[model samples]
Target: MEINLIFKIAAVGILITILGQILKHSGREEHAFLISLAGLILVLTWILPYIYDLFVMIQDLFDL
Candidate 1:
């Protein structure tokens, strides 16, 4: 699971970089910026649950 997530992030990063470059060179500056931001948000959405779970576990561990 960890390895898969690592690969997924790496791939997304590479793809976003390539996409941004392509968009910039194509004279779509605004769309390229938005595309990168959208990619970041998408990745964050996917990882939010895991982050929440981690915090919950920590809270329980310390009885917070």
Candidate 2:
């Protein structure tokens, strides 16, 4: 819900794209794949806390 988080995600995406392209072009397709996977994990780690918080909020709202 913050602009900074959006910017961080966008930056990560852009960095992953660039790094993947470089790895692919250098005949390191495996490395590129790894980079993509790492990027996905990194993003998930960043967002997971917020996701947990959202769930907690929903449960509280419903008195569950």
Candidate 3:
């Protein structure tokens, strides 16, 4: 929920896009794919804790 987290995610996405483009242009499409996948996983890891916390809060609110 912090602004910096959003910035960090955006920064990672930009860096990944740049790297992927470079790799693809260099004829390393497979590596570019892996880099994109890794970037996705990295972003998910960063956001998952917040998602889990939200779910927990919702569950508590509804007494689920």
- Which of the numbered candidates is closest to the native, going by highest TM-score? 3
Q: Mind giving the per-residue lDDT tens digits that candidate 1 earns over 1-64?
A: 3789878888898999999999999999999999899889988987998999999999999999
lDDT string, candidate 3, 6-42, tens digits: 9999999999999999999999999999999999999
What is the lDDT of every predicted structure here?
0.91, 0.96, 0.98
Q: Which order, best to worst by TM-score?
A: 3, 2, 1
Shift of residue 19 alpha carbon in model 1, Å? 0.6
Candidate 3: clashing pairs of residues: none
Would you list the clashing residue pairs of candidate 1? none
Candidate 1: where is the Cα deviation over 4 Å?
none
